[model samples]
Target: MGSVTTTEQDLRARAEEVLSTLAGEDARLREDQWTAIEALVAQHRRALVVQRTGWGKSAVYFVATALLREQGAGPTVIVSPLLALMRNQIDAAIRAGIVAVTVNSANNDEWDAVYADIENGDVDVLLVSPERLNNPDFRDRVLPKLAASAGMLVVDEAHCVSDWGHDFRPDYRRLRTLIVELPSGIPVLATTATANDRVVTDVSEQLDLGTGEQTLVLRGSLDRESLRLAVVPLPTPARRLAWLASKLDEMPGAGIVYTLTVQAAEDVAEFLTERGFAVRSYSGKTAPDERLDAEADLLGNRVKALVATSALGMGFDKPDLGFVVHLGAPASPVAYYQQIGRAGRALERAEVVLLPGREDRDIWAYFASLAFPPEPLVRQTLGVLSDQPLSTASIETRVDLSRTRLEMLLKVLDADGAAKRVKGGWIATGVDWHYDAERHRRVAEARRTEQQAMLDYIATDECRLVFLRRQLDDPDPTPCGRCDTCTGTVWSDDVSADGEAAADERLSRPGVEVPPRKMWPSGMAELGVDVSGKIAAGELAGVGRAIGRLSDIGWGTRLRELLGSEDRPADDVPVPSDVLDAVVRVLAGWGWERRPVGVIGIGSRTRPHQLEHLARRIAEIGRLPLLGTLPPVGEKPGARENSAQRLAAVWGGLDTAALPDLSGVDGPVLLVDDVLDTGWTMTVAARAVRRAGAPEVLPLTLAVDG
Candidate 1:
């Protein structure tokens, strides 16, 4: 016992040496940090650390790695969720005198060298994104060896493993298999800053090695004394934009402005830029090079803000970030807390504001719609997979889900062993799988509850910090003295009249170009359609115009009300005069190379009269001839199907006999429709019109569903 105690002291001394190297000469480990390292290195035990953002969670792992490596252990394996996090960790590890290497989708070419380094025992740590864990080559050829020899395994952002987590990821669930394969007695650590009590319990259970060993759980306070939290409720989208444009200059230092959707991010960035603010937009759609540039700009304080969607969340480390302003509320208080945590990390004070919008719930619902599909859909996807692997594209041809939704479902299926992803693609494993309907329903209910809690946070007069902490089940739920509610200080809700006018003008500016589809969806031949490959350039419809996207922050709200329900009787509604005026504005601003000489109407099964009225009015305004409307075929196509299936449904769905004699037409024809959804409808209809001898077809619509 005396020798054991002396050895622990020696280990502690060695740990302090490494911590000082990582954090400077004066650096010292806190008692909890030392305890965690000791648990992992000395006792060879598993641990779960739930601490605040800047509480040195990474330090614990780095120090543990140093100690374990000194004792001749294999390299640590960190299953990170984001590329940014992995990059930061690798740099930090190198600074701590440890050689850290990573293998992620972004660095595929370097993976071979990284594997060789790990095999040679030159690597002290190996960081991999969770998705890489399931890669066929990595999993089959390398993972078994890595698992057998891994000295320590670390799961960063570990809350993602639980479905109850606000940011649940299916790929993280695959860690369970990796955990089961790890050699017994190997130390494992999972760390997260956003988990509630439920999430902590779930993650702790997942960390168990199944050898009658319990995980050591360490949870710290979720408070941030430097964050001055507040809620700024704005009634309208225009008012919110105006507030941001006029008031952003008053906020301290460079930071981020969060939006709920990609469209919102782009719109906000454009508005701010027009108002002379130095800002850039970041989203999943942003190019990789552009994203890196944007990150650098923000880090260098070259830009006022980065208008971003949730793609900017997690793993972004900016220590002195001065502010975080939410243009819209996240769906849950937990997510909101995580975002705001990005601010005030290395500052004495930082501004954190939430400008809750009325449209936030709508956005939340749209995201919630992408959750795990129903049992029937899951069964259908599994049924389609066989011993012979099929690529995601091929599976998509058979399934109705969008690519994102389909990939998410497949990941979940693969994690559950109902399906397997191979080099070729994904295949069925012939394992019996049961859908956890009750659990999924409960998860859906939990999401709705979280949304309501966010609304409550926005509306409540209670201390915002206390409310958020309570939501996270923090041990000490005390009112933070820095919040607006606690101090009875509210930010000005004023927007300059000029700013409001500028925002209004920007929002009211109608018309977005709707580029025509230039290529046929693959597997069209499998759908029994004769067409395949590139669409003939001359045969395609020319670039057209729409009032706006139905998902846009501008005209979308009004268009949603105008379109109403698809099941609404077509005769019950009349075209709104405002919509007609907007359509006129679209044409007036259309810089077409050649003016259309006539108008053609596409028959709308749901709103034939509206389309006819719209077509006739356009011809009257332009002093052009009005062609007869095309008739609908056997049945209206269902909206929720693959592109190929949709194209097949509409192949002969239009009656060309009703088209007016196009030989007499002198120029291009304007084809009017209520909305443009898959573009297949317009594609098929335009082909029919051109086949009937129209010189060219230009599609026009009230809105486009992006």
Candidate 2:
């Protein structure tokens, strides 16, 4: 079955035989395939089919339209995006004697006649893109005619409806409204070659589909055995060209060389052609006829290779693509999967090479940031809105942007939920500046985090194919035997010896640990101090570790002596500069600390037993035990009880007389929350204690704050 269908039995039989003849030299079909094709045609309404790329997805709908028309079921309507694809489908239909017409940006007048035919039930299927459904002319005139005739609505690339998808188009969201407004309860047939779990949910929701009985007929294998994977590091332009040349000499079949930009494609194609290779360039700027010519030349082997952008593979299918090369890294794993899928369509052995360098990391990081609206720009855009609705043109003047850039910015603003369009005018819908600043700040941080995650994945030493398979949800995949690491052909030594290491192993370890510096024997002790902007459990634990290690190495007694017996004069609290030096000197000697690069961490070389003991001591550093209750205010007891009472009394008696007039203070107040078992509690406690003492208190808790 083909997209070209016929109303007459003899015509359909002749068309099927004709398609079978064309496919005889390429792909073979089975009886079950026709059964599946017939099942799809038999549906009275629109249906969705989830199948793999090479599964002959086009045939299902084409055959169905022909069968229905032959049985007097009237016409079908298709909305598609690509003009080239439409022509290809229409030509196939014409060959089968099935009546079909197209409406695209290129031929507005022709659509009128097509509409007339569709209204009279003279056509079988109407193919269309989601974008065309939004045109006011088509919506007002064309759609009503087809609706009156009870035609089926077919959406190709249906995954575009999902915002989560890589190819989302805002216009796709409007299809739901169209589907709802169509007559005869117009059923939709949504089809796509690639979709993950999230994409599947989006398809169902966007299409208004029933969950159980009205679901799609999913078919096809995820595996494509003919494809081979390879990675070649080309850190320099010269190295990249040389490697590409070598690949061309090795792989004989026609191929695609994908790059990040038009310039790269042009450069590579020119370079190859100069070397006596049959090569040509294809990019977004290439003319439609020229592009089609290039595609046909590549398919016929008249062109040895095509250096192209990712756009080259979307609609055209060349079954004998022997290789697909990535001249640069794709923006994402998803993009990479799609670009590489273009290869090996004939199910013959093929190769895919990814040439990624250090520059790619920065490139992708920059791309991620681009998706987020910058705070300054957004704030400026909001400031110009004047709290009034305005046409995009008027807003452009107020926003001080050229028409083109302003339109682009407005679209981004809308996507970010920062603005909205209503009543033929734009309105600022982003949050109020005062409250939304914090939210926007968080979003910025999230973008940074995601950018870091992507960088980490690229630099990771895991199997590349496995990572891709996981991301795409491809099933039962073996490590791509052709990738650099698997084939032992990689040039980068960054890949560790371990096939798969534990998470802890990913944590970079020091070459070797050094012993803590010895503390000089003297009256003076140095203390290091660092203040936190926010309190956290992890920080407290780290502080406990540093303190316990210090105490274990014999710095505890000296530390306790510094606090003295009674509350010091307000002015007597040790200055941070004085205390910081003493603490640093002492810790440096205790084998517990080392400030390397910019961060401090526990010395890994510390004796296991000592480290374990230190860990245990710091575990409860911040926790206070239940000290026994005190006697009434005046009644004194034994030394221990008396000491506790004295402590409580000093803190309790702070009221009237010339007390440090600390009221109405707005700054930080350090509290003596608990004791310190390890020095951490005392060190941290000292800072807090001094801060509460007034403008700042030095915390000197008896126990370490773990």
Give the top-scoring candidate (TM-score).
1
**Candidate 2 minimal-lDDT segment of 10 residues:** 596-605
- Per-model TM-score versus the true fold: 0.96, 0.57
User: Candidate 1 at residue 244, lDDT?
Assistant: 87
lDDT winner = 1
List, residue by residue over 1-706, the lDDT tens digit for candidate 1: 3355788889999999999989899999998999899999999999999898989999999999999998999999999988778878988898899999888878889988989999999999999888988899999998999999899999999989999999999899789989887888899999999999889888888888485788899988898989999898888889989998888998889999999888789989999999899999999899887988998899899999999988887888999899999998999999999888899798999999999877677678778878888988888899899999899877877878877789989998898899999988999999999999999999999999999999999989988888998899985767899989999998999989988889988877789899999989877676778887888765789899999887777787778778753443335366788888888899999998899988888887877777778888888989988887887988777766467667877888888877767877768999988888889989988888887888899999989876
Which lDDT values do the candidates have, in the order given?
0.88, 0.52
lDDT score for candidate 2 against the true structure: 0.52
Error of 2 at 490 (Å): 6.1
Candidate 1 all-Cα RMSD: 2.1
lDDT of 1: 0.88
